[model samples]
Structure formats: C-alpha cells, structure tokens
Target: MRKYALLISLLIIISAINLNAQDDNEKQLLKQFHSITSEEMSGWLEKLCSPEFNGRLSGTPEFVASAEWVASKLKEWNIKPAGDNNSYFQWFKWPYTIINETGSLTLNLRLSDGSVIRKNYQYPNDFYPGMNSGSGEITAEVVFVGFGVTAPELNYDDYKGIDVKGKIVLMNRDVPHTDPRNPEYKKWVAYCYHQYKLENAVRHGAAGMLYVDGASANPNITYDPSIIVCGIGPQPLEDIFAGIKTTNKALIEKIRASFKPASFNTGKVMTIKANTTRVNEGRACNVIGYIEGTDPVLKNEVILIGGHLDAVGNAGRVVNGALDNGSGVVDIMGAAKALAQSEIKTKRSIAFIFIGGEEVGLIGSKVYTANPSFPVGKSVVFINLDMVGNGTGFYVSAGSSYKEYLKYFEQANAKYIHRPMRTAAPEAGEYYGRPRSDEVVFRTAGFRTMAMWTTEATKKVYYHLPGDDTDAVTIDIMEDVAKMIYLALTEMANDPEIKF
Candidate 1:
C-alpha cells in the first residue's frame, strides 16, 4: 500500500512539473508576441498605404513595387525567399477587363404620337455599365420582370409565362423580404444570389438587362457577361416609365409587399447602345518567404500566413485601402517578424505570402495553389488576415470541419488575447463563407484554412472607399489583432499532432 502511494505521489509530482513547464513556455511566447509593437506595424502600414503605392492595383507598376518592398522586408527579417527561381516573387498573369471612359448608355423611347424621344444617361450617376458588360447595341421592346428570381423548388418563378425573347428586360435589384418561419425561406436565400438572377434573365432569351435599384434591392450586384447589364438609378427608371400606365413606385410597392411576380409590357420600344473598351492588364505576383522549422519530419509540413497586397485601382481618385488590406498586409508582416525574431522554434515551417490581385478576385492565391512553390498537399493550415483594423474584438472563421484547428485560436484568445472571439462556420453566410477572402482558394483546394478579422461591420464602413486611408485604420485594434494571430501561429506551428 505504501509503494502504491509513493507511485501515485511521483505521478502527481511529474504532472505538476509538466504543467509548470507549459506555463513558462506560454509566458515566453506571449512576451515574444508582444515584441511586435504598434509602431512596427504602423510603420509598415504607412509605407504600404502611402500615395507612392498608387493603391497597389494588381498587374500595375505600383503593385509590383509593393511586392518588391514586402520581399525586402522579409529579407531583413532573415526569412528565406520561398518563391520561384530562388526569389521572393511567384509571378503569374492576372488578366482582367476594365471599363473605360468610352462606355455610354442611351435610351430611346418611341412615343404614341409617332415621335421618338432620346435621352442619354450619364456614367456613374444615372446609370453605370456592368464590369462584365459587352460592347453591344440593342433596340427592342421593353418588358418589366420583378426581382428576376426563379425557384422551381419553392414553386416561385418570376419568369413564368413571360416571353422576354430578344427583348430588353428591366428587373428590380433585390429579393423580397422573407419570413424566417416560412418553409421557402431557405430556398429564397439560396437563389437570391446575383448570378442566379442573371442566369434566369439569360435563360429567358433576353437581349439586354437593366437593373432598377429599388429600396429593397441590393445596390451592389455582380455583373453578368452573357448580356449587357446596366444599373439604372431610381430617377432614370421613373423617367423610363413616364408614359406607361403603371408607375415605378406602385410596381415596387406591390413587389415588396407580396414577393410575387409583377410582369408587364410597356408599349415603349427601348433602345440601348453601350460601348466599352476592354483592357487586359497582364501579370501580378505573390511575395513568399519562409522560416525553417527545427524538427526535420515536421518541417516538411507548412503553415501559410497571408494577406492580399492589392486594392481597388485608382478611380479618378486614389483609394489608399489602408483598412481594406493595408492593415491586413501589416498584420501578416507583424506575425512574420515576431515569429522570425523569437528563439521559439516551431516544429513546422511558416510561410508568409503577400498576394496580389485579391481585390479583383482570389486570383493571386488561386494562382499560387495551382502552381505552388511548396507542395500544397503538405500545407497543414492557412491563416488569412484581411480588414483587421477596426472594432473591439476578433472574428475567427474556419468552418465546422476545422473545429480542431479552431480550438487553438480559442485557447490562444483565452490565454493571451482575452478578447471576444466569434467562432463561425463557412455556412454562417457572407460573414464566414468561402467568398470572404484568399482563404477561400486554399479551403477549396482541400486544405484546412482560417480567416481572422478585427470586425466585419465596423471595417466595412471604409472598405473600398476613397477615405480608406491611413487615418481610417485603428492602430491599437490592429496591434491587438497582430498579437492574437502571432500567438495563434506560434501555437499551431509548434503542435505536432494537429491534423488537417
């Protein structure tokens, strides 16, 4: 019995010693993470968001300069270049179409008095051509289609019994308000995407589409290249329906209230002519650097830390994008610096990637995944930082499938950050969905991925606006986020048993 008690006491002593060692290791890591200061992060952000960068538009000289600068910083941190040809740049072509000033929209109406009236709408105010709009001219009868949604599963079809063949169809920009208690709510939400609406319009054999922005419609809709899609403001739409029996206001009210089809043919022959110049901007790069791990076996595994370095190009005025992604770039830089300088050696290699062309699409990250410098299958996890410059706390989204990886973040937040952490699955809607950021590309490639942001709502106020400059970023909030991510990366890189 005495021998048994001694054995039990020994086990307890060993457990206490192990716990003490862990506590010490955590304290050491926290101290190293705190070494990444606000000033350090802000200095990098100032340069990244500076006027010299010219908004860091992808496939432009300004964007290339930003990439080179990031590579230089990684070199300064003693991080090895992890790009093609022994350099820090993974170069790839990023082709896209840009609408030039030559684009114009004109509406012609044939009056009952045998007279024709023509009115030209100004760009960006009365109407704006879609991003994917093709250069075309169409003169056809105008048909009104409400909401432009068609769902056979819910027994709701907006295009039902409507012959829109070879005619210009006018549609409201939004889906109707759905009651959560209704059985069709889920179906309504799923089919409410702009692509579905455009597909419905094309499927109905419409020659062109003009989206009227109603109070209930989504103002910012994705463009469909299948036909010429243009956005008509409320005033322009009202003018288009001036001679028609039904008023725009009346039709909008009916559609909003009932969520039913409101289709009609105005005896107005509409003519739409649009001329757009498509410019193909060539290639952009992803800046990559790595810190080798201590353990040989685990070093084969990789942890990806990245943020997009591109912003919406200059639109008459500079869009600094300080908070949109400048903050994100600095966040990753801060993490890289913290990890590289610390004595703490992770078991797995860490790669810092500053991706380009993220504003246009997930092009940079997708290109990397398609032709990666490091084996993508060997990637253990990806941490994407974007718009982490506002709000009080952090939002960690990894989807439910990555709950095991998310626990590291939860534990880190509890121990080091002590900030509110919102754990969200990808299906939690736009907030945590695959459409959010570069993490989407990695996640789609079957790699475990996580995204961290300071706040979604607060950061969006300056998201892509011209006012998204250095002054818009909340430095203190960004500092906290940087620390949180640094700690999380350290913990994840050190853990050996974590499986994707």
Candidate 2:
C-alpha cells in the first residue's frame, strides 16, 4: 500500500511538470506573436515602394538589388540558405521588355463632308501602353476578333471570314467556354495565354492589336517586333461600337451560346504608337531560405511559404505594387523573423521563398519547381500569399479534396486571431483553371497547395497601377496575418504525423 501511494504521487508530479512546460511554450508563442506590429510592417512596405527599387520588375538591376536586400534580412535572422550552391538565389533566364514612354491612341472619325475628327484618349484611364509593343506606329481600320482563338479541332475560329491583314485587330482575353469544371475548358487552356493571343494575332497578318483587358498594365504578353499593341478601356470599347445595332455584350453572349464566330469590321480607323526596347539576355532569380528542423527523421519534410516580389515595373511611370504583393512579402518576413528567434524548435523544416518574375510570367515558380532545393515529394504542403493587405477579414482556400491540410490554418485563425474568417475548399476541377498565380505552378507540379486572401477590402485596389502604394494597404491586417502564419506554420512543422 505504501508503494502504491508513492507511485500515485510521482504520477501527479509528472503531470504538473508537463502542464508547466506547456504554459512556458504558450508564453514563448505569445511573445513572438505580439512582436509583429503594424508599424514595423508599414516600414518594410515603405522601403519596397521606394523609388530606388524601380517598381521591382524582375530581370532588372533594381530587382536584383531588392532581392539581395531580402536575402540580407534572412541572413540577419539566421535563416539558413537553401538555394543553389548554398546561396539564397535560384537563377533563371527571363527576357523582359521596357516601355520607354506613355504612347498615344487616337480614334479617327470620317465625316460625310470629307473631314476626319480625331479623338485622343488619355493615359491609363482610356488606354495603357503595351508592355511588349514594337517601337513604331500603325494606322489601320479596326477589326473585332472575338477572343482571338482558332481551334480547328474544336470547329471554332474567330478569324474566319474576316479580313484582318494589315489591320488593327481588337480581341478579348479568354476562350468562350467559360465554365472550368466542364472538362472542355482544359482543351481551351492552351489558347488562354496572353502570349498565345498576341502570337495568333500576328499569325493572322494583323498590323497591331488593341487588347481589351480593362485598360490595365499587363506584362505577360510576348514581344514581337512586327506588331504594336495597347490595352483599351471602356471609353474606347464603347466608341468602337458606337453606331452598331447590337452591343459588345450582346455579341459575346450570342457567340458563347452557339459556338459561332461574330467577327466584323468596326469601320473605325485608329492609330497606335509605342516606343519600347526588348532585352533578350535579361536574367532573374528566386530568393530562397529555410529553417532546419531539430528532429533527424522529420527534418526531411518541409513546409513552403511563398509570395511574389515582382510587380509590373514602369509603364512610362512607376507602378509601385505595395498592396499587390509588398504586403505579402513583408508579412512573410515578419513571420520568418519571429520563427528564427523562437526558442521552441519544430520537427519539420520550414522554407521561406520570395518568388520573382511573377509579373512577366510564372517564371520564378517554374524555375524553383524544375530544380527544387529539396525533393518535391518530401514537401508536405505549400502556402501562397498574394495581395493580402487590404481587407477587413481573412479568407483561406485549398483543394476541397484535402480538408486535413486546410484544418491547420483554420484552427489557427479560430483559436487565436479571431477575425471574420471564411474558408473554402474548392473542388480540383473548378479550382485549377488558369495558370494565373504561383499556386497554379505548384499545384500543377503535384504539390499540395493553399492560398490566403483578404476579404472585404476597405480601400480601392490599384491593380498593376501607380495608385498601389503603401497607403493602399491595411497594415493592421497584415500584422495579424503574419502572426497567424507564425503560429500555424510552427505548430504544423512540429507535428510528426501531419496528414496532407
């Protein structure tokens, strides 16, 4: 009986020790969580938006400088390098284009009295100079080519019965089969690229292109010295259909309903002029660093978190991408610093990637996926953050098939940072549509992927525009996101049997 009593007392003492250890861990986590502040995040954002970085366009000297700055911070925080040759960068060849100055777009109206009335549109609002246009001007009649697709196998061709030779062709972005889950959308995916559209327009003998992409700056188009291009806004589009009996909206709807072509001549003469230079030998890189885990066996498994650090550069003027991705980069930086400073050690490795060349294309992600620092099969999951700094609440999305991976972030947000959160698990068919984000590249490479997005934005978003400065971001939310990621990622990495 005395021996039994002794055993019971020892068990009680062990329980008390475990409880105290848990308390200590909680204290340490809270310390790091509170260390993330809005002021610090704002300061980091300001530096990214500074004029010296030249808007952080990849394949430029300014972009390389910005990447080096980020790598220096990782070194300061003691995050070990996991890139090529034990350095912090994975290099790749990324040819880029520079728009020299704001170009001009004029609409010519021919009157019955043998006089022409010319209307010149304003910069950025009515028209955006093409990022990859040739250094010349073209004057031709406008031909409306719907979506600019020609899939002979699918029995569809937008350029059929249309004479666009030596003419300016106005085209939309994507194919007509809008539903992504129908499985037919995948067939049209090859034609959904901006590069493909530009090339198709060139192949059709068009002299120039007026892309109808919301008049926003797009750097994803291919560079061809034979053609000049520009993005047109609502004013110009409306003017193109001024006297037509049917509206542009009606024509698109009719085309979608019956897989037929609605090509026509707008009878409008327009002039597009651009001055640009293309550098074929430009190069870019991805900034990569990792925190090695303590456990011998579990350390092989890695959790990757990344955000793009490249913006649209300057379209005659600097497009400071503060809210576009500066917020995401700084948010990850905050989490990285806290993780490196924490006393507690995770069982699985954690990697922080500041992806480059995302604006021109998904080049950075492609490079990393092609030659991963760690084995791709050993990666547990990838978390991507883009434009996550201008909202009232939080939103998390993952493939609906993988509810286990989603729970880690969901539980973290629910337990600690109790903001209005919405979680989505979109099906694989509906989720993986276009190759738009970095997550797409990772997902296509068979890596489990999830993304964090902000909801209910409080301010106007200046996507790929000059207004996307530090003021466009909500610093408070960014701080919270950093804290949340810091807590969740550490906990996830420490788990020995994390199911994907």
Top model number, lDDT: 2
Model 1 stretches astray by more than 4 angstroms: 1-31, 98-129, 132-276, 425-436, 456-460
Candidate 2 off by > 4 Å: 1-9, 427-432
Query: On a 0 to 1 TM-score scale, where does candidate 2 land against the true structure?
Result: 0.96
Instruction: Write one digit per residue (lDDT tens) for candidate 1, span 322-354.
Output: 887898889888888889988788999999989
Each candidate structure's TM-score, on Cα atoms with residue i matched to residue i, is: 0.73, 0.96
- Tally clashing residue pairs in candidate 2: 0
Look at candidate 2 and give me any clashing residue pairs.
Answer: none
Q: At residue 499, give the lDDT of candidate 1.
A: 61
Q: Write the per-residue lDDT of candidate 2 for residues 264-362, one digit (tens) a residue.
A: 999999999998888888888999999999999999999999999988888877888998899999999999999999888899999999999999888
How well does candidate 2 score on lDDT at residue 408? Answer: 75
Name the lDDT value of residue 133 in candidate 2.
88
Could you tell me which 10 consecutive residues in candidate 1 have the lowest summed lDDT?
213-222
